[model samples]
Target: MESTKDYRQLPNSSDHYCFGCSPLNPSGLQMNFFADQNTVISNVTIPDHLCGWSNIAHGGVLTTILDEIMSWAALHFIKRITMTRSMNIEFIKPVYIRNPLKAEGKVLEITGKHDAVMEGILYNDKGVACAKSTARFAIFSPKVAKRFGIADDNSLNFFANVFGIK
Candidate 1:
């Protein structure tokens, strides 16, 4: 698939040490993402140290990838801060370490103003789906998130700027 041209690269803050997308976390996945009309996507290769059995990528790490991608999808498309309320994952095939993979997330539906249903899928280099996830997220505006103290000032400001919140 095409990695650019049609897709816009999403930004990440240097202030937070997120295990999924942070640049400052030495042991983190350091994944980056791009956005198109319908979805947010990430391409990455699992490191050997993150393997569960032999060269197979761990289920939990894969879950983290799905969660992160889905969260970003909610943030980008819904223009809200999100927290995972529930999720279900299916392991369709094995994902090997050191092999390139793609993870994608998109909003399936928005329930009311506060909740969204998201879907995340992980694919191998050959484009075979290795795993899938569906999740419910509790979305919050930047102002509400800041008031609730769930997100710090740096993140709230970044979201506010990115989403053009007044």
Candidate 2:
């Protein structure tokens, strides 16, 4: 099947250290996120080390990809820092190592100034849906951002760039 529409890759700060999207994480996924309007997307291949069964990708890893993409959707389109408050994932099929996979995330709704609902999906090489997820997030206001060390102007600017806040 055809792939997702071509999208622009988002930016990350020099000090960014996220396990999923950080280029600096030597052993992490180092996934790159791109945007399709309100959605965030990532295409990647699962490595052996991230697998569960002999050649099957771990559920945790798959879940992480979902969370990362959805969180990015919120951060980018919603322009807020959010944490997953609750989530449900259904694994439809086993994802094998070395298979090209795609993850997609979209903000379903903004429940409140500090709350949002989001959805995500995982597609295997042939574009069959292998997993699906939905989640609730708690967006951090400026006050909460301070407790997380993201209150500084520089840090906010960095996040704004990462999320494409114009």
Candidate 3:
């Protein structure tokens, strides 16, 4: 388990988030990720209420976990805030709702300005690969940040803290 100091303690992104990554929304997944050296890892225990069919975890939920991890990994390595431009995922096996899952992501390659390719994997309690994902992210610039109505200084500071950037 990570201490609060080791985690990214920051405000939520927006008010309405059906996506699993946002922490502000009560119904969201509220998944938190931390940087471990060069990789980002998160442990999640699926709740019975979030199961899709029977006792299996929902596919959509699995995708969200992969997406979030990949995006965070990119931000950590690139030292910039970014948004996913494209993502592809493959579900290898069914994830059980009662079991704990571990997700990890790393930067594969950094393309020109604000562009990066990241890869991530999800493993079951037994360490089996349950799912995998790859994503392309575009880093947000000051101009883009203002256009999106996102707080530039606060958001950049959040990533800087995670990446240990000055």
| lDDT, candidate 1, 46-110, per-residue tens | 88889999999999999999999999898889988899999999999999999999999999999
> Tens-digit lDDT track for model 3 on 1-166?
2243555532335544646666676666677677756787777777787899999999988988898888767766777667889999999999998787888889988898878999999999888999999998887765576578754576556545546433
Alpha-carbon lDDT, every model: 0.90, 0.83, 0.76
Question: Which residue segments of model 3 deviate by more than 4 Å?
Answer: 1-24, 150-153, 161-166
lDDT of 2 by residue, 9-126 (tens): 7776657677788889876788877887777888878788899989999999999999988988888888877889999999999899888988889999999988999999999978
Q: Count the backbone clashes (under 3 Å) in each candidate.
A: 0, 0, 0
lDDT of 1: 0.90
Would you give me the overall lDDT of model 2?
Answer: 0.83
Q: Which segments of model 1 are wrong by more than 4 Å?
A: none
Candidate number with the higher TM-score (2 or 3) = 2
TM-score of 1: 0.95
